[model samples]
Target chain A: MANLTAALTALPAFLMVSLLLLAAVAYLFRDWERTVAIIAGVYTSGLAFWFWRMDLSQPTQMLLGRPIQLVAPLTVGDFTFQVQTLNAPVIALGLAMGAAAFLLAARASQGHTFVPLGLTLLAGYSALFMAAEGPLAPTLLTPLFLIGLSAVSAFILQAGRVGRVAGPLRLLIPPILAFPFILVATWYIDQIALNPQDNQPAQMAALFIAFGYLLLLAPTPLHSAQTSSAETAPPVALTLATLLYQLAVLYMLFRTISAFPFVVQDAPLASWLEWAGLATAVWGGIAAFGAVHAGRLWGYSALHDWGVILMVLATAGARSLPLALFLLGLRTISMFTAAAGLSVLEQQTGGLSAASLRGAASRLPWNSAAFLLGGLGLVGFPLSAGFPGHWAAFQIVAETDWRQAAVVLIASGGAIFSYIRLARILFGPLANRSLLRERPLSAAMAAAILLISVSLALAPQLLDGPVSYILSAFNG
Target chain B: MEQLFAGLDFFATETGVLIIMAVIGLMILTWDWRVALAGLVVVQTGVAAMGVARTGLPAQWAGVQVAVMLIAAAMLAISAVQTPTSRSLRQAGNWPLRTLAVVLIYLAWRTIDVTIPVPGIAPDMAGLFTWLGLAMLLMLGLSDNPLFSVVALLLWFIPAQVAVAGIVPHPSIFALIGGLELLVTLTASYLILVDRLPAAARRPVMTDVVFPDQEPKDWGVTDDAEEVVDALPLPGFVQDMVDSGRAARRSQPPALPAPNSAAPALPLPPGGSENGETISEQTAAKEQG
Candidate 1:
């Protein structure tokens, strides 16, 4: 009974991953992978809330009273970084996203045979994150790395040969172009390890890496592709990948920042980041205005969200970073969920452009609601998880430069307006017309979307705790 | 050792007025005006990118002055052309003449700072650029003409990215400019041609329901309070012709079934077949679905 009470109390922190892993393994071959994934997300999200509320550590210090030391690579060349895994929140998110993706696939009527692999992927990421010491080894990292690799490979394998995406070669180039830069950069970094040095060069390198990913994302006209290739992905798979790229990469980069405060402290670098965020935000907004496609609109909105976060982080003091981490975690999860839900809507038309959505709402009411609320939540619309982070960020800005913050809002208007446009298309007046009506969304898909929105609205605090944990861990 | 490909490197100082002249001459002699125009835009953008991006420019302004002179030479070639080119290729007045105008404008605006409010902070350099870009996008994105919008998008996006990364002392992102421009231009073409599909209304002449004899009583409009012929899924030109033909019913109005509010019709429908009534009824019902 005492154990049961402790488990119930701990539901927000660990139950989500454990339960999800159990269900994923149990139903790895079941037809309800879609439904199962959603259940997992709910538990995982609850875990984030529990962490946020209790923040159990006291006299919180890095290493929790142990002297922190950077593990020196036995040799600068061919050094191995390793640790046993233990983080609860990150594992929970990874599982939640993985499950949510599986659920999305299931919602689309695919078999859930892939659930076990996804669960393993979650476990791998968890083990890396949850360790008493946060250092990771290349060997231990292999499994999680395989998640990204296998996700892409599995999709191609499932596609099985008849590649009909031949409409525009120009449309296909951006995503292809992007991979090489990231792959090359990651390869180069793995080749060499520097002394735990100052932050400036590291910041510069991280900025380049982030830009490499952004190039692949191709938010606006600047991209070489005519079509957003991301539209071809499984909603869940794409969501999981995006969460990994946008927030995970960001967290990794932030962790590295502590080793180089001088970079962040450099006024020129700080000003540059502010400028970059502003540009990204405004550019995203403009693109949103011209966004005639649902996926593109959401994609641009995500960019804007990234910009907002970047701006805040750029301006924030070290003490303020916990808030930024909190927001990033909340949005990464929320956006992944929303993007997954949008996948269902995309299927009815076999596409996801703004025009494709003509009369889409009648078939997938709940899914559309999920896309809408999720987009709003990601953008920090009034009461969503985004709002609190944005509000706090603004307060921080107001102390320094209220005028600039006002401008940031104006630039962010692109996200706000585009989301409104998406809503209008999905649930507007009965003026929408269609010729071949799309099939209605599956119950699992609809349920998953609703759950994501509700979770985001109900308990963003769940996210706050894990973020603090990560920060505390990094504080060493 | 003799350096073979040293000239090819961007850092090589051998690049000068001769190179600029050669490029301008190539634009005039071998290239199409559109290519020339794009080239000109590229050159100016490259210069701006150099100043704004961390890429160091030629150590001396002498090269820049020479480059401008060559640009003037290219403009002269464009103005001298007999054939008009694609608007995108209008480099004649754009480079020499337009460049002059921009210079004058800059001279005037340099004295004044145009700042705008943004979210949560003061207008830093990147913030200022963003405001400018947004304003440009609003003007261009909302334009009725597709081509104009594309041009505006270019104007807005490039400067915006440059401004954002510029203020940082160690700015480094060239692929962003090249790659993004390619994507934006191509996507616009796709949207216009593929996504914004034009609905075709193909029908033979006899399908027109208008009477051939007298001015037709009630103009084929029934007690249903809807014009029978108006209900056909036809483009304006075809619908006009069908209305004029005033022909007999064709194929029993193509056997339209009772309206399912959840299902919307395809692109074209036969005339009559209870079209308007079915649409409004279906739409009203669709809301509840």
Candidate 2:
């Protein structure tokens, strides 16, 4: 165990070394893509298992019962700070995320050159967050995450361009706008210099990060910039990838928020969140009011999903975090399923215009079912994975202010209208030629959607353990 | 009254105003001009809702003022992205949208008063409203497909999150990176949505735009070739970089056929192949630059 911790503590440096090795080899040998992905995934799974195993008893952290170098400093300008490394579980998570990215890269039409790199960065981030001793960890992770997301975004954007609808301007700009915030946040990290003894600054820093991530979850103005680079057939996995980031960001929020309820649970802050959620939901819905594109409709539903989480997280309690985390899983399933169906539809027809896809469902009823199911999830319809989380959120909010709950519900109505409208479009009486030409359904896409929907439906508790485990860190 | 005239006017004092400006600049950079214009309107709304340096009713109606600002923003968004064929219109089309960007910026800055600050949460109302405006602007600007537009608009979250997280080290840094993350996300989304277009199967303006699997034949002749010639040249640095078979050009592709209507506009058969990255597009971009 001690050796494991020692190895794990040195993991960040090891990851950097590995990234170099992979990058060197990846360009020359494309065949290693699958192997890299598998290793990354297994690595993450291992970390996750370790996280569970180590923290099994209480809110305890025993890292292979060993002491690794607590901190290593990097000097930029006058600042000399060592980056902190995290525990096995978080490192595992990085591995897992990387693994997932690896799998996705492999599944993509082109073997993603960026996947291995992204996984390494994500692993580094997880390691920093979970094991690092000082403020530098979060700061380091911030830049690393920015780089990782950008890589993912860039790859996906390239994929989208390759797919068609090239010149996706949306892909490049949002990251540029976000760069300043990162620079500023990094500076703060340097200033705080949180010693290993106290996790307050790091935790609080994360809360702040989460607070910002709430908007990220929704992606309002820079929305086009956010998703302009969607190039795959079923954009679900890609969407899921984004959601995974959101999950991490939200987890950062919940745990941190719990620790600092004074700052987090304030009326003004909560009010801002509430109104923002309402406005975002309503605004996103109105935006989708006459949406013609099926994918666009899905995007609107996504906005609604973010709004739900925003509202739920606005209220502070043990339940809120669990539900918020749970909600993420549901959102993942629902969003991914819908993206898969839409991917199929897009593949069948070339575009997603309303006039063209007048009655697509009548042809591929099963895929349509998946699409509808995803839509249901978006609106938090009963039995859908999206349901329970929203319900829990609403239930909590309603207890305090029914009006707020009503607002959230009204916002949700936009998504429902959208879904119903889509169904109407899919089964419409328009006389235009079938905009959709049938391709044999992709078993992978179908199975993926079915699995997402089924898991969302059957295994609500899959989230329970993780959520509780994360929440335990809150001191609540 | 003393607080109102403290000389640190809302526009001058609030950091979010700058953030709003940054957001607008970024939106213009990424989205179509129409969406960018909507972002401009939100900036105006931020000014109005947040108020001028030291003007307007500084108290008693901050929420309503902000709401009004948001309403204006929403109205502008609807007008800008609304296709010519919609249920009904409270306003005319092209001209109204054309005027929105600069007009809203002027309106917001000239009106609303955000003299008061929300302690512990730096930047005050001006900053707060800017975040809200940024989100609204995106939601409105992305009027192409509600689904797509909404996501694009959600890019506003980056700034909004920045606001809540404060200008402190952790949140600011995280939010900034979040902004970039958003940028990548929106761009990817744009790519994803466009790729979903069935017109893809027909032929590509560039040979490289073809899905590796479906492989678009010789389709994009429309004005692609002509346009390519007129494109701006790539800078020397980029020009030096290697591209596909084609040398980097400083001009646009010549007039190519519309990839959508030129081939299969009606049928959407979603599909593709491996090696999804477009070697040609990158070369084309470099050449066009």
Candidate 3:
């Protein structure tokens, strides 16, 4: 057993390689939905566990009387994949989210490629976080390229049999636009390294980097793809893909700031994040109010919640990341719960349009309730999982500027208002129509999700230990 | 040692410019899917050649780029072939508008005269690339068909890539870019193929009909509603046509079933069918009416 453990520790990049290989296996067994889901779920959970238990401080340890070399960086050819202590928890969070998506796919339908494609994306993300300088630096430019490629892959995965390709196609535009700017920024960064005295290169680098991240962050006008995708793509796939990309981008943002302090000192990056957050949050809410489709409304609500998290991120840069992550953790629960219910609802109803879902609650009561409560959680309504984090964030923002808090509160009302409208339609008169009944296993899954949400709402303290551990990664 | 066949020298020449322009123009102007795809192959080949020359990229890398482009074009062609309903050899609709747009884009590119600051590339080559980029962008904006849009998008990548190569000509970078292009092509092909698939394959057939408990709406005027149609107070010509049609229908026997068939020998729903019309025939007639 000790020898086996040592052999595994001797290969640090083993997890990434295994993830990729497992993804291929999942693709091969995609016809067996249960098998694919099981493989994906177990593999991701295993990865999360590995990251959680990793002791990066120790390079070598005695295992069964043999010295086992345990290092973070794994060199493959010229490229090195390192486990950055600061990014481990974030990676674990992403993996956990992926695991949830996979396990849910066991019961719900997230399309044919959701498991394999999702696992592939996770592998790319892990490689990205663990990458160190070789032929290309892991800093910003190489990741941008990887993101562009990932976006193309995502576009394919999201395009399924659904005829709406517009949303998936829109996702391709931002990365295409961001790449050149970051490429130029990298050149400028190299120039700065050669000539340290001149602030010109740093300024140029800052400007270009800002433009790149602005597009990558995808606030306001650039947010249509996300909303459109939610309406068209499978909910679980959308949740996993969106969360994975957002978390990776968040980490990239922090890493970029750490690498170049002038980004905050010389550039208006802080203001950009703050204003962008405000606009995005407010717009998300207002948009939600008018969304007639259940899927679109769910998307808008998430967008609004994302806005609040962004505001938290803008508060004190790295200092506020833990709070933001806490909110994101709550968001993961809300999204997973809602996606589970929504996927089942879409499957039975054949569509998510408001007219199609008339009196859906009368047929699939448990799933309906799950969808409703989960959506409400996104808007941070009282008695929901998201309420505590949102309320805390609001209080924290109000301490610095009460008006900002008020804006967020007022915007949140828009999603709440939308949810209320959705609730009426769901529970209204049956209208002499019939819908497919929810499966027993599906109901059980939804019940489990509901229990988790209620438990989190009642005992918000359950998140403290994880959040604090994640925060410690950044504290260094 | 003499430097033989130095990079991008051909692209700087007038002949190279004309060939590039002709290929792009053919791609944008042609309505034929086959012809458009042919133009795409030519454009990609030229891009690969130019990148190899300009950046001194390895032959293997250039081969990879060319091979990927060929496969992408083949995928698009296969989809086009599979979709029999796709129009072939038809004159492009609004050709004048497309032509004018193309001309206007080219004029704008020339008028702006903006210098691209890509290192180690000639000025003429840069100008040519800029023009090609703008033309591809225009094509992307104007296209409505997914196949054509994908082709334009792929073409746009060439110039952007050449610029990137000029700045950082790493083999890994080129390989990554090639892989992404292939993935995009695969996705576009899948969408095109699926779009042309039968309706049942796209969405659940159950959603096509109203729930069993809900009554389906009757939009057309039935025999019982003839009076209502007559009372609409339509113009004389229209009313005459309707009356004539009804008279013609009355003169004819039932569209289907024998005059002494088993359909009439059996019990029939009251007022639903006359003569020896089968239930299916009656339903068809009702639908037609």
Candidate 4:
């Protein structure tokens, strides 16, 4: 058991090797979708359990009054991977989402490409979260992430049959533009590290880093690629591109901010983030309300959720940090479930427009239910997965400024209206009745996902232990 | 090495090379494939000259720059040639727009200060780097053609690489940058090829239809027959003759041929004889008969 713990301590190395192995296996067994799915499922779930065990060790140590380290840091060639309190939950949520996405792909029969791409994305996110804070780390990891992202985009373009050069160009250009800023930030941060007294460059570097993240995250004005992707890309590919990629970039941004605390203390810089976040949220909600396409609606809702998360981070208060992390976790689960359900619905209907989906509930009841549940959760409705995190964020904001809270409420209300409108369209009179029948495996899997969301909503206490540990790290 | 560079100071100075680079960059903005390829080679020469001046490396190092440029240029030329001629060449006759873009790019570059300076690089060289980078970005924004965009992207990397070389000066980093540049160039070539393939040969890319059930019709048209005839691009005389012939045939009733009779042959047009007779000769022959 002790040896097992020691071996697992080299999590980064293991994860990278596992990524290569899974990709090879997937390629070699491309003809057998079931085998690839099983391999991906075991790997992702194993990583998630490993994170859970690491998170559990702190409580066990405190209760037993002994220094019990379940996971230790591994260092190799100036790179280190330590299971910190903050990243454990983040990594766990990401792996869990990967697991669910892979399972959905398998059940839905979304082709052999999903397993390899999903594993590659999982590895990228894990490495991103595990990257230590230093000049070399950001500089090295930024390019690595861009290369991985480019590969994923290429695959998605190939699988989705997206013939337009614009889609792939849009995906590739932003990272290229963002890379220079990250490199500049790295140089400045290194300068600061060398001479601790130079604080000006640190602040400047933070702003640059924030800008790079904004480009990666695709806030309101820069969000066309994501929406186009959602419309054209396959469900599994869309999930990887938008939900998984967004979460990884957000965590990377968080790590950057945590490394340089002074950047948050800069008043004008933080205020800019606040304003940008607010504007993006309001705009995204309005755009979502006006969207007739189901995929665009999902894209806008994701944008709105990210806007709120950014606002929470912009507050730069210790209290808001944990709330941000909590909301991120909840949003991931809900978004994955929602996106998976949409993918299934799209496959069954051959389209996702309101007209095509009219009265779809009578045909794909499980998918419709999952979509509705996921949408409602994103809107922060009661008994939905996003309720606790969003409610907490509201309370925290209201104590400081009522106006920001009001804006948040309006965005939530707009999202709720959009979801309700979608529900009406989905359950209304049958538009083009067909003989298509839902697959039992996919239906059951989607229902299980919905059940998980409902359970998370009904009992938010399930996240208490992890959230507390994350918060404790911030305090220390 | 310094003495050698001094001997060629007319074109090797920072300001002199920048002027040459700017000219090549503007030529690229014209979006002509042949001209752009030539301009890119010039741009690479400028880069190598500036690199030698800044780093004081031996003249042999310039071979690396020329080699990379030749490889990249070869790839671009192949992609351009394979592309249909109708799509490959475009003329940017809108001089005002081009002029405005250049002015704006220059101003933007001028306004930006290189806060982190490389020890050996002068202020003018840094400014030139900024100018080159912005110009590439402008070119990328203005063009939608994959080949042109790829060229612009490749150009954008050179300025950044040159600037970083002055700062880092490490061979491994240079090697890494070189490899990355090669990868990007190859990838861009692949994208161009994929873009040019026939729709059926390409992978399926699903597009959402705006109106699925509506039958396509010409709006505000009452006479469908006349509209179809009017849409044909034949000469007026030819169309008139065709219409008259069709009407005459449709109006006449078919006569039944006798059981043992051969079908009557129709007369050919004046110049339509099998033996290549001229219209004038046929007319004279008819008159003689």
Q: Chain B TM-score for each model? A: 0.29, 0.32, 0.61, 0.59
- What is the per-residue lDDT of model 1 for residues B1-289, given as tens digits with 9 covering 90 to 100? 0121122333122242234323333333222334444544543434343332233322232133224424433443333232122222111121233234334443444456554321122234333334334333332322222233444444444333333333221212233333344444444343333222221122212323122111222221121211221233333443454445333332224344568644444322334223444543544454457
lDDT of 2 at B52: 31
- State the DockQ of every prediction: 0.02, 0.12, 0.17, 0.13
lDDT score at residue A342, model 2, on the 0-100 scale: 65
CAPRI-style quality class for the chain A–B interface of candidate 1? incorrect
Models 1 onward score TM values of 0.47, 0.55, 0.78, 0.75
Off by over 4 Å in 1: A1-81, A84-92, A109-232, A260-262, A265-268, A428-452, A474-476, B1-289
Model 3's CAPRI class is: incorrect
State the TM-score for model 3.
Answer: 0.78
Q: Please report, as a residue range, the 10-residue window in candidate 1 chain A with the lowest summed lDDT.
A: A68-77
Cα displacement (angstroms), candidate 1, residue B28, comes to 19
Best by lDDT: 3
lDDT of 2 by residue, A1-476 (tens): 87544444443444445455655555455556556555554654554564445532332233567433434333323223332222343344444444544554443323344544454445435433543233333432333354445445445334433433321334333333443333334433444564645555544444444444443444455454333323332353456346555655554444334533434533255666776666666655665555556766676677767777777767766576567656765776676676656656665555566765677767655566677788678778777778877788789889878987787687677667777888888876644465443445354556666776777676777777755554444333
Q: Which candidate should be chosen as best, given DockQ against the real structure?
A: 3
The lDDT of each candidate is 0.45, 0.48, 0.71, 0.64
Q: Please give, as one word, the docking class of candidate 4.
A: incorrect
- For the second chain of model 4, what is the TM-score against the true structure's chain B? 0.59
Worst 10 residues of 2 chain A by lDDT: A77-86
Task: Estimate, for each residue in A22-97, the C-alpha lDDT of model 1 and write its tens digit.
Answer: 6556465455655655565554455445433333343221333432222211121222222212233444455555
Question: For candidate 4, lDDT tens digit of each residue in B1-289?
Answer: 4454455445557577666666655665444565666777777667667667666644554556556777988997887667533233122223345566787766665577543343355766666666666767777666544667767766766665565555445555455556656656666666666655432111111121112112122212111122121222333443465467556644665454579986444344332354554434544464467
Of the native A-B interface contacts, what share survives in model 4?
A: 0.06
Number of clashes found in candidate 3 = 1
Ranking by TM-score: 3, 4, 2, 1
Worst ten in a row by lDDT for model 2 chain B: B84-93
